[model samples]
Target: MFDLSQFIFFVIGCLATFALVCLLFPHLFTRQKKFYPKRVITAFESRMFTRLKDAFPHHHILAQVAFSALITHDQIKMRNQFNRKVTDFVVLDREYNVVAIIELDDPSHIGKEQEDAERDAMLIAAGYTVIRYTQIPSIRQLQRDIR
Candidate 1:
C-alpha cells in the first residue's frame, strides 16, 4: 500500500522528534561562544615581568610561558613526569633560544619543592639555566646571571 498519507505522517514525525530534541538541549543546537578574557600574569608576576623587560631590553622576557611551548611533545615524556607545567618566566635570547628559566619562590610553593626540583633538573639537563628567587633580583644580578 503506497500511501502518500503515511509518507507525509512519517516525515512529520521525524521533524517533530528533531524539534523536540533541539528544544530539550538548546546548548547542543546553538552556536557556542569560545573566546574569554584572562590575565596573562598575576599581579606579583606582572611587576617582575616589567622589571625583566626593563633589565633585558634586548632579550625576550616571556611571562607565564608553558613548558609545552618550549619543549616538544615527545621530549616532555623523556624529560619528566609532570605534564604541561608552566614557568613563571622564560628568558630567551634574540634568536628565541631559551636563556634561562626564572621561578618565583613564595610560601605557596613550599609543599611542591620536590616537583620544583624535578622541573629544575630537567631544565638544567636540557642546557637551560634555572634561577629561583624569593624576592626580585637586582637588575645587575640578572645581567650577571644571564651573562
Candidate 2:
C-alpha cells in the first residue's frame, strides 16, 4: 500500500540523491570557467618595466608582447612556434616600430641558455633585435644596447 508518509520520504530521498550527484560531479550540471585574471608581469619584471619607462622616456614600452605581434611566417609550423611565445618587453620608437625585444633573464634562465638562444636566433633571422639581460642594466647601458 502507498502511504502519504512513504511517498514523502521517497521524494526527499530522490532529492537528496540528486543533490549529491550535482555536488560530486559539478561539471555535469555547471559550465566550467576556462580563464581567470592574472598578473601581467613578475616582481622583477615590474621593476625592470619601471626602468624601461624612465630610460626611454620618449619611446613606448610594452610588456609581455606576443611574439606573433612582432613577427609572422607563412608556414603554419613556424607560426605555431611563436604563436604562444611572449617577449618580456618590447621597446618601440616614436614611430611605433619595434626597436628591440628585451628579455630579463633571472636565475630561472640558468639552464635555459640554449632555448633562449634558439628563440633569439629565430627573432634575429626575422630581422628583429633581441636583447637579454641578467640584471637591470644601467640607463646608459640600455641606451647603448638599443641605440
Candidate 3:
C-alpha cells in the first residue's frame, strides 16, 4: 500500500544534497591534513643543488648533466637514491629495467673497494651492469661508455 517510488525519490534527494554540498564546499567533507613538522631536505634541495652545481666548477660538475645526457641520447633514466641502499646510482632503460648500477667514488670511498666490489657483485647477480666512476670523465668519455 505504501509508495515505493516516494521512498526511492527521498533517498535520491538525500544523495543529491550530499553531492551538492561536496561540490560546493569540497574541503569540508575531507579530513584536514595534519602537518608533522620535521627538518628534512626535499626535492627542492636537488633543484637548488642543481643551480649551485652550475656555478661551481669541478671534475664531476657535469655528472648530473652527463646522466641526463645519457638518458636523452641512449634512452636511459637516472633516479636519485633516497634510501641508503647498496647502490648509489641506478640506470634504467626505456622499459624501466635496471640496466646499470653506477657508483661515483670520491675520497670517502678510497679504502672501501672490497665492500664496493661485493655490492657490485650483488648488482651483477641481479642482472645489472655495474659502473664505478672514480673520476668524472669528459662528456666524450661518458658518451662512449653510456651509448
Candidate 4:
C-alpha cells in the first residue's frame, strides 16, 4: 500500500524510534555485566593465612603483599622486576616491623624453583629473610623458622 516515498518515511520513522529507545535505555542494547567481589587469596592461601595467624598469635600476618610495599629500588628497571610481584605472606613482629617474607610452595610452585630463588635473592639482597615452605608448618616449626 505504501509508495516509494511513504516506504522511505516509514523506515526513517522506525530507525528514529529505535535510536530514541537506545538513547533512553542504552544498557538494553548492550551486554549487561554484574561484577561481584572475588576472593583476594586462593583456597590454599586462605588456609595458610589461618595457619599463620594461629602460629603467631602476637604477630601480624599479611597475605598477598607486593614487594613494592616493603622495598623500593632507585633504578626503574630494578623496580619493575619486583614492584608488582606479590609475596604470599609477610610476617610482621608485634611492633609491625617486617620479620620475614614467606612463600608457600604448593604443587603450583614445582617448576618455579629458579624464579622463586631469584625473587628470594632480591629480598635477601634487601636484608629480608625469605622462607619457602613446601607444606604448612606446625606452630612450633613456624616459631622456630621465624626466629
Best by lDDT: 2
TM-score to native of every candidate shown: 0.68, 0.79, 0.42, 0.74
Q: What is the C-alpha RMSD of each candidate to the true structure, in Å?
A: 5.3, 4.6, 12.4, 5.5
Clash totals in order: 0, 0, 0, 0
lDDT string, candidate 1, 1-147, tens digits: 799999999999999999999999888877986788999877878888888888899999988777766665367456355456788999988999888999988788888999899888877766788999888888888788777
Please identify model 1 stretches exceeding 4 Å from their true place. 1-36, 73-80
Model 2 alpha-carbon miss at residue 136, Å: 0.8
Model 4: per-residue Cα lDDT over 6-27, one tens digit each: 9999999999999999999998
The best candidate by TM-score is: 2
The local distance difference test score of model 1 is: 0.83
Ten contiguous residues with the weakest lDDT in model 4: 26-35
lDDT of each: 0.83, 0.93, 0.53, 0.91
Give per-residue CA lDDT, model 2, range 7-72, as digits (tens). Answer: 999999999999999999988997867788899999999999999999999999999999888889
Error of 3 at 48 (Å): 15
Task: Give the local distance difference test score of model 4.
Answer: 0.91
**Candidate 3 lDDT tens digits, 1-147:** 889999999999999999999999988978987789963333433343343234332313222323222322222221232123444444455555554555667787889998787666645654557777766555555445644
